[model samples]
Target: MERRTISVTGMSCNGCEQNVESALQNIEGVTRVEADRGGDTVEIVTEDDVADDDIEAAIENAGYDVAT
Candidate 1:
């Protein structure tokens, strides 16, 4: 598995974290997702073929912004 930690913004509470986690988990290659609202970050574990644009899009679609 490949792991990536992405800085994210607009997560303010536990529910926000859950939203981010759930969104990322829906990706086919993703095996794990951990969102920390306090740190404004989301850590994900996924298959090697997963694309970074897909991850950023998932976060954006979930109403958050992935730090550039």
Candidate 2:
């Protein structure tokens, strides 16, 4: 499995974390997603190849920004 921790912004509560988690969970090959608004980070586990760009796009679509 591939593990990644992505920094994110604009997540201030549980709902924001859920939104981020839901968005990431839709990606193929993603096995797990954990979003922590308090820490401004989202951790993801994937069973196959997954691009960072795809993850960033998902976060944006969920009305959040991925920290650069």
Top TM-score hit? 1
**Residue 18 of candidate 2: its Cα lDDT?**
96
Alpha-carbon local distance difference test for all models: 0.95, 0.94
Alpha-carbon error at 57 in model 1, in Å? 0.4
lDDT of 2 by residue, 44-66 (tens): 99876898889999999999999
- Residues 1-68 of candidate 1 have per-residue lDDT tens digits of 99999999999999999999999999999999999999999999999999999999999999999998
Over 4 Å off in model 1, which ranges?
none
In candidate 1, which residue pairs clash?
none
RMSD, one per candidate, in order: 0.5, 0.7
Residue 44 miss distance in model 1 (angstroms): 0.4
Off by over 4 Å in 2: none
Which candidate leads in lDDT? 1
Candidate 1, position 33, lDDT: 95
